[model samples]
Target chain A: MRSHRDFARGFRESLAGGPAPQNATAQDPAEIERRFDVYRNNVAHGLTQALARHFPAIERLLGADCFRGLARAYIAEHPPRTPVLTEWGGAFPAYLADEPSLQSLSYLPDVARIEWARSRAYHAADSEPIAPERLQETATRAGTDLCLDLHPSVQVLQLLTPAGSIWASQQPGGPAPPRAKEWRPETLLIARRGISHVITSVVRSSTGRFVSALRAGDTVARARDRAGADFDLNAALLLLVENALIVGAGIETGDES
Target chain B: MTLPRKAGLGFKPEHFPAITETKPDLGFFEIHAENYMGAGGMPHAMLERLRADYALSVHGVGLSIGGPDPLDRDHLARLKLLCDRYDPESFSEHLAWASHGGVWMHDLLPLPYTAETLSLICDHVDEVQEHLGRRMLLENPATYVLFDDSDIPETEFLTEISQRTGCGLLLDVNNVFVSCVNHRQDPRAYLEAFPLNRVGEIHLAGHEEEELPSGPLLIDSHGREVAEPVWALYAEIVSKTGPLPSLIEWDNDVPDFATLMAEAKRASMILSGDHHALTS
Candidate 1:
C-alpha cells in the first residue's frame, strides 16, 4: 500500500522515463506497463504541445520535427514549476542558449527571448497609462529629477542579432525583412496598448538605453545622460508618452530649502 | 448559475472574429481558465465582448486539485479574479491532478480512490469553492492506468467528494467512454452509477484510439469531432439527465468555426430530443 505521496512520486518518475511503480493496477503486468507507457507518452506529448504553443516562431525556425525533438529535451531538463502552462516556458530561452548542438542557430536563443518577452507583455498586468498632462506637470516640477514608471507589460530587449525582426517576419501578414549581411545589435521595445493588443517595435540603441535606465528607476536627467549625447531624449519621451507606455511619473523634490 | 439546456462550443482564439461576427446560437461558451489567466490582452478583450453576448463557463485545466501538496493559493486568487470579472454561469475542473511538488505535469494524472486521496480532493474542492465564492462542478478524469490501492469505485469516490464538499459534478461523457475503454470497463455502467442528478454540465469531445499490444487504448485527445460511440453514450446520458448544458470541446487539431458550430448543432438536436438528427 503506497502512500499518496509515494504514488505520486513514482508516477512522476515513470512519466519522466523512469521504471514503472509496482503498484499500478491492471489484469496483467504487461498491460500495466503498456498503459503506463501511454500515460508517459501523453505527459510528454502534452508538455511538448505547451512548449510549441509558447515558441511558435522557434518551431517555424527549427521546423516541427526538429523543434519537437528539442522541446522534448528541454522539457526533461526544465519541467514547468507552475501549473500555469502560459508561464511554463520562462527558462526555454536560456536553455536554448546553453544547448551545445544548437550552436549553429546562434540567434535562436535571442529569438526565444523575444518570444518570451512578447508572451509576458501580452499577459502582463493591466495599468492605466499616465495622462500626458500629468507627465508634463511632473516634467515641469522636477525637470531633470523626474522619474517615470513604464507599464507592467513594457519589455526592453537588447540582442546581438536581428532576432526581433526574425520573429516579426514569422508573424502573420508580416513580410520577412532581408537578413543583415553583418551581425547588427538590435534593440526591441514591447508593450501591450489594448486589452488584446501587443505592440512591438525596433528602436534605436539610444532609446533602448534610455528606457532601460528609466525602468531601473533613474531620473529623467540621469537616464538621458546614460543614453549618451547622441540619444534623442525628447523624441524618446514623446514615444513613451504617445504609446501610453509610461504608467506613472513622479518628481523627487529633495528638501526644498 | 444555470446555463441554457442547449449545446455550446469551447471558445478558441482562432475563431474569435467569426464567433463575434456571427454570434452563433450557442447556449454558452466555455474556455479553459488557464488560457485567460494573463493580466490583460486580446484574450480578455475578446472574452469581454463574448461575455456580453453568451453565458460563459470557466473550465479550469491546471488547478491540480488532487495533488499531494496544498492548493496553489496564487492560482486560486487568479481564478477567482477571472470568475469575478466574467461572472460566468458555471465553473468546472477535472477530477485529476496535473501538478505534484510544485512541478506541473501538463496532462491530468490519475490517483487511487482511497480515504487519503478522497480527503485530499474534498479539501481541495472546498478550498476552491470557498476561494472562488461559488460552487464548482468537478468532472471525472480520463485515465489509462489504475492503482492497486484503490478500494473505492470511481463513482463512489466522486459521490463522496460531492457530498462532502457540496459541489456539483461535471460529467464528461467522452472521458467516461475513454477511461472505460482504456480500463476494459463498460461506459454505460459507469454512467449508470454516476450521480447524473448532480451533474451541472456535460462535456462531449473526440478521442483517438492507440492500438497497444495489450488492447486498444482510447486517448481523450479532444482534437477532432465527437465520435459516434461517444455521441451515442452522450445521448444515453442526456436522455437520462434531460438536457444538461452540453459543450462540444475541440481543443487540439481545432477545426474551423463552422465545424465546431455544426457539432454544437448536432448536440443541440440531441438535447432537444430530435431523434431525426440522431438518426441522420
Candidate 2:
C-alpha cells in the first residue's frame, strides 16, 4: 500500500505531465494513460483559465494562443503554492520578465505587475480614510515632521515603460491611452476608494518619490527634501487626499531632524 | 441553520444585479468560500445584500481535507471568519485533496481509499467542524483515475468518513455520473450504496465528454448544461431521498442570469415533484 504522502507526490508529478504512477489502477495500461492525460488536461486548463482571468491585459497583448502557451509554461514551472486561486499568479510578472522569448515585449511584465496590484487592492481590507481635518492638524502641529500612514490597500509601482497607460487603454470602455514615444518610466498608485471601488493613477516622478518616502515612514520634511525642490508638495498632498489613499496621519515620535 | 428543500443556483458576480433586482425564487445561493475570503470588497458587499433575502450555502473548494499533510491552519482561520461573517445555512468541501507540501495543485486529485487515508480525512473534517463551530458536508469527487492500493469502495469510504466525523454528505449527482462512466462502473449501483439518509445537499453540474482510444472520458468541466443521464440519476436520487437543497452550478462560460435561473427553476420543479418539468 502506498502512503498518502507518496500518492499525492506522485499524483502531482503526473498532473504536471510526468508518467503515470506505478500504483495507479485501471482496467489496462491504455486506460491508465488516458486517465492520466485527463487529469493533466484538467490541471493545465484550470490554471490557464485562472491566469487568463487575472491578467487580461497580458492576454490581450499576447493574444489567446500565445498567452495559453505562456500560461502552460508558467504553470509547469510555478504551480500555485496556495489553494487560493486569486493569489496564484504572484510570481508571473517575474517569470515573464525572465523569459528570453518575451524580452521583446518589455512592457508585458510591468502590465502584469499592475494587474496583480489591482487584484490585491480589490480584495484588500477596508478602512476608514483619514479625515482631512486630522491631516491638517498634523501638518499644523508637526510642520515638517508629519508622517502619514497609507491605507492598507495602497500600492505604488514604478515601471520602466508606459504599462499603466497600456493597462488603462485595455479596460472595457477606457479611451485609447497615449503611446510612449521614448523609454520614459512611469509610476502608479493603486488604492481602493469609497467602499469597494479600486482607483489607480499615474503620478509624476517627483510625486512618486515623495509618496514612496512617506510610505517608507519618512517625515513630511524628509520626504519633501528627497522629492527635490521642484516637487509640488501641495499637489501631491491633494492627490492623496482626493483619492482617499492616506488612512492615518500623526506626528513622528522619534527625532529624525 | 438548514436550507429549504428546494433548488438554488451558485452565486456569480455577473448575476448579482439580476438576483437582487428580480429576486429570483431561489431556495438558497451557494458561494465558493474562497471567493469571499477577502477581508472586504464588492464580493462581500454583494453577498451582504443578497444574504438579507436568501439562505446561503458556503461551499469551500480549497480546504484540501483529503490531503496527507495536516489541515492548513491559516486557511481554516480564514474560512471560520467567513462563516462567522455570513452565518451561512450550510458549509461544505470536497473529499479529494488539492494541496500537498504547501503547494496547491488547483485540481481535485483522487486519494487511495485505505485505512490511513480514511483516518486522515476524518480527522481533518473533525478539525474543520470544530473550528468553524458548525457541521460541514463533504462532497464526493469526480475522479478520473483509481489507485491500485485502494481497498474500499468510494461510497463506503464516504460513509465511514461521515459516520466517524459526524459530517453530512453532499452528493454531487454529476460527479457520480462522471466518475462511474470513467471507471466503467454502474452509476445506479454507486447511488444505491451511497448513504442517502446522511446526505444534506446535492450538487448538479455540467460535464464535457472527451474521446480517447480506450473510451469516452467525461470531464466534470461545469461549463455547460447538465447532461441527460446526470439528470436522470438526479431524478432517481430525488425519488429515494426526497427533495434536498440541490444547487445548479455553472462556473465556466456562464450564460446570462436568466439562463442560470432557468436551470434552477428546472431543478426546483423536480424537487417540488413536478416531474413534467424535467421533460419539458
By lDDT, the best candidate is 2
TM-score of B chain for each model? Answer: 0.98, 0.98
In each prediction, how many residue pairs overlap at the backbone (N, C-alpha, C within less than 3 A)?
4, 0
The 0-to-1 C-alpha lDDT of every candidate, in the order given, reads 0.88, 0.88
Lowest lDDT 10-mer window, candidate 1 chain B? B271-280
The 10-residue segment with the lowest total lDDT in model 2 chain B: B271-280
Candidate 2, B97-189: lDDT as tens digits: 889999887777888899999999999999999999999999999988888788999999999999999999999999999999888899999
TM-score of chain B of 1: 0.98
> Candidate 2, TM-score vs. the true structure?
0.95
Error of 1 at A223 (Å): 1.6
TM-score of candidate 1 versus the correct structure, residues matched by position: 0.94
Candidate 2, B130: how far from true, in Å?
A: 2.0
